[model samples]
Target: MKVDRVLLIAGGRSGEHEVSLSSAAGVLEALPYDADVAVIAKDGSWLLGPDALDAIDAGEAASGGHPFPPPVAWGDYDVAFPLLHGRWGEDGTIQGFFEMLGLPYVGAGVTASAVCMDKDLSKRVLQQAGLPVVPWEVVRKGEPAFVGLEPPFFVKPANAGSSVGIARVERYAELQKALEEAFRYDEKVVVEQAVSEARELEVALLGNVRAEASVVGEIRYDAEFYDYETKYTAGAAELVIPAALDPGTQETVQEMAVRAYRLLGVRGMARVDFFMSGEGELYLNELNTIPGFTPFSMYPRLWQASGLTYPELLSRLVELALE
Candidate 1:
């Protein structure tokens, strides 16, 4: 299917609002078709076109500052390419809204988006499917903090991206503050044992029914880990495409990434991250259904290394949505 008018949705009511806008900017610059822009304000107002604020409100009357019905009509475009990240956008809300509108959009569906957004649920599902995941424990707010694992553990919100609410606690004394910080973003928190001397590897997957994994990529950072700052700040971290892994290990990582993508029923695209322990054990980390598309983002860079240009990637994603 040839795509003409593309709905480029971006900026949502989430901690990742700025990130979403940046990603959408990249998409807007590279998209090959005629694309319209929609900005979802932090207060949940759906503003269409460049004059978002002062422009005419096309959505249903704001009911308590929440736009129940989106202003975008199904006939306005052929497909939607949502660059909204984090809570209200990537966590299945917008996906469901598009479904109700009977509009095809890029990335995973409602169920996959919701499931992958929750760390605890995604880990459990991956574990049940005989996939290797880091050993971890879950805790809820107001519950007795259980440092069941070792002191070097990571505390993160159950449903968040871009490392918004993540803490690396190296000692038991730091557990309380870390958990409290994590609880700020979500009621449920996850505590996972930190993988020591592990190299972070990521694989990008694309497709609807049949997925294809890109060449493996490695993340090298000077920080304790790939936190939010290291991720967005240019030069803070280096992405080594076609990660220097042995042939066997490279194939293994790519295969596992595709398996996880299919297991989660991810359509369109996903960036599957993994931890390669010093001991050679591979631990499957969380999957980002709608990974960042910034110039420095790994998802598009990996594809670029694998022969897909930025514009080509954007066009391919829109095509996947149409399919």
Candidate 2:
């Protein structure tokens, strides 16, 4: 199947909008040399010509502030690849819209997107399904207190990504400030028990059934956590391809990644994140259904190390969607 036009949709109603733009640019660069690439910016506008930098500076999109333009017509393009992360973009919203528009897209469908977007919900589903997730509590707005979860915890928005509104608090006194910061991006905040000496590991799972897992990659954040800066800012962290792990542990992590993928009904591709404790326990962190497709992104990097190049990976994703 040959794709004529590839639409890389980015800049969404989320705090990770800037990162989304960066991801879109990477996708454009990875497009097949023969395919035509079109860039869509924030504010539901289009970007053309060679001035990518100038167009990005002209407009910005904020959550609940950027109104989507008229829905895209079916067959406007061969496939819609949304690199947007967080809230409106990663959740079922945009996926549902495209489905209604009858457009084929790269990545998970509506139900899977919605489940994976909600941290609390996704954890519940995974844990209930016999998967391992960290201890946490979901605090809805207006609650006088968040309890049953230990302090020195992480307070984050339930739906945002790239750790946009995540805060690490060590005491009860700091809970208020953390929740307030988290609420700025989302009304619901997740207070999770901190995992000390925890290793940040991620596995890129591609394909439908018989999905393959990229060699696990470990990320060392220069910052406290892998926040927006650590993820986007140059040299904010170190990426370890083929994370050092015993063969047994590696196999378990890969199996868990596939299990999580199917449990959530993920389709084309997903990056399953995990925390490798000192005891060698691979705990599920969260799954990124529409994980970044950038060249430097772990999703592609892991695959590259696993013998697939960026262009080949993009080609596979397009084929998976249109096949």
Q: Pick the candidate with the highest TM-score.
A: 1
How would you encode candidate 2's per-residue C-alpha lDDT over 1-323 as one tens digit per residue? 66677666777657777777777777777788333333345444544434333434433433221234533344658888887788878898889978987888888899999999899999999999999999998888887764677777899999988988898888888999899899998788889888877999999999976688989989997677788778878888898999988888889999999999988899899999999877877689999988876699889999999999999999899888886
* Model 1 per-residue lDDT tens digits across residues 93-201: 9899889788889999999999999999999999999999999999999888766898688999998999998999998998888988888889999999899899999
How many clashes does each candidate structure show, in the order listed?
0, 0
Error of 1 at 232 (Å): 1.2
Task: List the global CA lDDT of all models.
Answer: 0.86, 0.80
Each prediction's TM-score versus the true structure = 0.94, 0.91
When summed lDDT is taken over every stretch of 10 residues in candidate 1, the lowest stretch is: 55-64
CA RMSD of all predictions: 3.5, 2.8
lDDT of model 1 at position 20:
81
The TM-score, computed over Cα atoms with residue i paired to residue i, of candidate 1 is: 0.94
Model 2, residue pairs in steric clash: none
